[model samples]
Target: MFKMKEKWRYLKTEDKTAYANMAIDRAVLVANSECKVSPTVRFFTWNPPAISIGYFQSLEDEVNLEMCKNIGVDYVRRITGGGAVYHESELTYSIVIPESHPQVPKNIMESYGRICGAVIKGLKNLGINSNYIPVNDIIADGKKISGNAQTRKLKTVLQHGTILTDVDVNKMFLLLKVPDEKIKDKLIADVKQRVTSIKHILGDDINFNETAKAMKAGFEEEFNVDLVEGQLTSYEKELAKRFEIEFFGSKQWNHRR
Candidate 1:
């Protein structure tokens, strides 16, 4: 059985835009590699709202650009692959581990499953039963409660996921063009009925801090490792500053179709 090392760091960041959050994830990965920082887990949220398209998705196909601008929502591309996602009323979690680490699974799907298992445990603690769907989703009653993506480089892997605490289903439908022929209205209605949130499932508002603490505890218990509260290393901070100016904040990267 694989076991993680004792050294693990946890970071909880202030709310940021989607692009900056993604850039920070990459910067942390680079910093970990260069500084040999221990495996890291980060929790964060978005502010001013944003929409993120998957690494390989076409913006025109996935987003209504005019609608987004009119609504004051920013748009950016993710470093990981998945369908487009609207990032509001969501808490995002990311874990970066060296590929050489024993706890890091060899297969991508296995890695996702392991990380999502922590989320499942966390939600269960709050009385919201959730299950990990293969390939990177956490589902509750057949509707997606969370979605994840992964990126690997230089013998390091970064896995991140979004936990949908609350979402605007109607606005989501409006911003992204759903294939009308794929699913009939009845099936769509069924999906909406099944998809739910902590608030929906438990009949109470789920606070972000409570959720984050629960998730951190779940990770600690699942991995059987002590988590040290930490901040971004100097290297990571510098890299994030550079990345924000050059790529994440650039129109070329954001508008690149």
Candidate 2:
């Protein structure tokens, strides 16, 4: 005799500032670890065009704050470490699982690979032939369509990534700093060549909602679990607010070395 596995919570949240979004993800991670909520598959959007630097990134080095201000772009630091990402017209998803979950791997790289594999599967469900490229990226036709980051906290593993509905290389370059001006043109060209989007691949027939549906199906199938729609608990919301005030919204936290 065997027991049936539990279903995952599917959190469909509205667009929010970069700060609130990251704070919520961290709060969910903590809540799940403390047995407050079921493991979650959260999908969200960024309201204004935003820039998020990796937790360990030097904001001064990677981002041009003046440019962000001039363009009215929101910015925040993520708890999970990764390269800087400009959030414009993209869909973001986060998965929170207890560290002891059977699906999670003990090895860090293996954990990354496991999450990226689910992402690849999600892209595939969207009609894109995407593949997990070793670490934390999902590529299609040799160009990156998705990039992910992971972190562990309170005995839980949280992984999040973005699926570009469309890529704005020019805008992205405006926010992220390039070391050499001489090679700036070349760098932009190289980036355009290396990154892709769902709209680019599937044309106008596909959209954000459709892409999200595909990803939801992909994760459910990949993990062999169901996605039951849910919302953040009051405790998680309060914790997120504290995180926003103390960390995501604070210059000290964003610029901390």
Candidate 3:
């Protein structure tokens, strides 16, 4: 989609708490919207692991807070809308670019497919062929290996998603609420059948750094850009800090639904 300059910033994977991670994503979106930073592709992992619920989702309805607290898993609300996701043994990536950018499609579905193509290519680099399914999912070996969500704000678009390195369906189900207790087991089994991970597919674990490297190349190849390693700017850092304290880290904001 990009035909202009073939360059983008690569913010290598960083491990952080749920709040800090979300803050950085929002901060980057703001900075990119203002043209203060190059369009960025960043990767991150949730420290202590976490469950992030979608923007319109209710925390109480979607998550089991007592279970989360007991398991030492953190929780946060995402600016993007999607089902609650259990983040563990996974690589999460976010892309930030102005909505008016020449490469951005006016149609949402096309845009999702175009962006997710980068992920499909990344999975190919890992020797696991994958395809982008409409809406927002990547399937490998006929099972979902990644799920993505996107939102538009501040005249910019932000899309973030998880590529599973490993998966523990039982642990994930424990942290999420099922509408019916009786159907919980059935749901879990269904998910197990439908979702997959890199470890499961490759019969081994792929470290975060290695996965990030492959993903970085995926974006570079898809966009035909050179992904130069970089760090968050001073403005972005300060904004992230403020955003964490005021929004991502705030109970009122998280529970606002």
For each candidate in turn, the TM-score is 0.92, 0.97, 0.97
Q: After superposing candidate 2 on the true structure, give the runs of residues whose Cα lies further than 4 Å from its correct spot.
A: 2-5
Candidate 1, residues 1-257, lDDT tens digits: the string is 97765969999986788777988898988877765578899999888688888888888877888888898888888788887888888778999988878887898889888888888987887777888989988998678889899989877899888888886777776677666647645555765775677777777788789889888887887777877899988778888888887777788776677
Candidate 1, 104: how far from true, in Å? 1.1
Q: Best candidate, lDDT-wise?
A: 3
Model 3 lDDT per residue over 150-194, tens place: 999998989999999999999999999999999998999999999
Runs in model 1 deviating more than 4 A are 1-5, 180-191
Clash count list over all predictions = 0, 0, 0
On a 0 to 1 TM-score scale, where does candidate 2 land against the true structure?
Answer: 0.97
